[model samples]
Target: MGQEMYAMLNQDQRSIADTILASHRTQSTTTADSCFFIDGQGIYVMTVAWTGIAASLLPEGRTVHSRFKLPVPILKTSTSSIRPNNEAPMAPCYALNAVDILLRDIMNIDAPFGGKIMILGGDFRQVLPVIRLANRSELIAASLKSSNLWPYFKVIHLHQNMRTGPGEEEFSKSLIKLGNGELTSNEDDEIELPSSYVPTLCNRTILCPKNEHSLLVNEEALQRLPETEKTYTSVDEVECEDGDDITNYPTEVLNSRTPSGMPPHKLKLKIGAIVMLLRNLDVHQGLCNGI
Candidate 1:
């Protein structure tokens, strides 16, 4: 085994990825620790938002993404936007700087993968790091750019928005100006929206003040549609070694603990119902997770 490993590590070595798999194939006990300190067994390709990573590090195990362990390798998430709030676990109360903590961890990455690079990227204009009781400046201060470790980072600026289509350069430029702080209205950081952009009908984005308001408005609009309603219920199960535990899941508890953004187990739909996908299964054809 030693000779084989020596040959594997030296002359006839495979890619680092393959070597890791080889170790797993041989049931190397240290493989798990050498990779990560978590039960990353079936979590082959995990993706999480920046704030999701931060929230997972909480000592209290109040992780909104996955069960908390410690010191997992960082990887770019599916979308890799790191745009504040998107899929992140929002924790307003648990104070202390989260971005700083995440950066500090990068600064002290231990051996085996200590040479790993951490790239932090995001647009502050979209959403500042929102702390529970923080003000505007405080929110700004919570961003990774505000951390002491930020000096060591090599910044990369993307001047172009590749997603912008033809005849939308002006619109894209307006967005760039907004992001760069070159464009602003006299109002409280509010910009004028084109009258045509605001949707009074279907097939466009509509901004609402609150979730409840959005839902209520949608419900009202859908009422006018002459489609029959169909209802579906969800199956509830508890994860436990004991077979008996699975059936013991209380409906109330299951419903309460159901993830916030997950499609409800019980769902109602009509023939002409307007439904938005929550995941991007295709990109080339513009079939993505969001809209």
Candidate 2:
């Protein structure tokens, strides 16, 4: 169905579709050899070579010698997968190594020539490379030093939590607190005080239950309020035994008539509510506080 829809798109839309497809194809082939290709006069060349040295040696003596040129634009953009082991810890080795190669060989070769380099992945908290550290203390010390090669590069930390919902935002905060051993009864009290604000708790006990007899459950419930439905009478009637109710419930009633209606449930601000404000709004005024 998606393929048919994609095929039916106009020329301008098809161009975008082609660009996306090409990007996916590029990402799928992850080796240094497979990513790059030579193009000239609307002709597509081969996409892979045996090795960097082999690729450098190709343009001069090969059968396609006249067809190609040296210092071929090699794209070392995407990286291959890193496997995890029981003995080692996680680190950004493959990514760093790729960057090193890009700096030393790819970028350095055939000087006086320059090209635009763009990096488009973030969400660093989501996934990191599984690296086997030979010396942990040394690596840590090296990472800390500003003079080291690691610090020479610029890093853009993305502040926006695009993937998470309101519930997820609360859960993640709780997890951070739990990991730091700062979660206490005081924090719980703060979260569950106001009647207007519902506390979003991270139920970590469900992560690993002690015994097979014990049942683990997630307590968070999603409230969904349809535009046609005014009041949510069903919220009170529904009873969840395992606490695994994943239905989105509409907590507050929305003004269906108004186009720019208020959100069903507005987050209540407390003393220590860790809130993320929208970038454009005033940080002091428009901040919606509460986890």
Candidate 3:
């Protein structure tokens, strides 16, 4: 969508789009999943992975001459009629935000006629837009507040998760944590070590010390288990990959007490329990026997 629109923009407009697009593309591989809005310039760009229907909807390509230029309005609204209060006058307004205009004029006709619009893009976790918002929430909030027509607008939530795998999941999680100021490491705590100390070669050296420490700890724990028979019984040994044996100590422990009115045999129970019962007089009085 953005690419087609970019081709129609004038030289100055193209320059602005190029600048914004370049900045986003250089950041990370995920840069492709970003949307851009140039305020005052009235230029917006969105990129999504190829969709046949969307491509078909785009205007047919034509040769570009110096005379060719982008449309003044991406979408234009029809003139509204006035009803007398006896005939109260109503104004025809167009949605400036492209997504809002697209949805109102195209996708969902039953959507509101005019109002402030909240456009949200979650491209960071999905396909990056051709142009990305520098600050998403702030820009959306500002756009919504700018219009007083309906005073309020519907919030459009873009739901798509394109990133997969544990590494990508962890990266997204870290981004969310950082946004909420819950990042584990503080800026001041980060230390710069001498370049020579950095490990360039990754192999057994990385695991050796840590593996030895784990083995020693396991051995010490196993040695103490036999003497503590009253608390622990039957220590089973399992070999681990790092030359360490995991000692599993099993002991019978009392889990829970019987319910107040339930008999011992009838009481369904377990250790670390919580029980809930549904409402019905014919049943066990809406109480959970064991939870």
Model 1 C-alpha lDDT per residue in residues 1-291, reported as the tens digit of each score: 545654544222334335434544554222132331110023132223334333233222122222222222222221111111222312221221233344335546432223222222345556554455768776555555554434544333445564677877887777767767787577676777555433575455578876656766777777787988888787766778998776677766786553535666656678888776554444334343444
lDDT minimum window of 10 residues, candidate 3: 82-91
Report the number of the highest-TM-score candidate: 1
lDDT of 3: 0.32
- Of 1 and 3, the candidate ahead on lDDT is 1
Task: Return the lDDT, model 1, position 115.
Answer: 27
TM-score on alpha carbons, each prediction: 0.45, 0.26, 0.22
As for TM-score, the candidate ahead, 1 or 3, is 1
Clashes in candidate 2: how many? Answer: 8
Query: For candidate 2, which ten residues in a row score worst on lDDT?
Result: 81-90
RMSD of each: 13.9, 22.3, 25.6
lDDT of each: 0.44, 0.30, 0.32
TM-score ranking, best first: 1, 2, 3
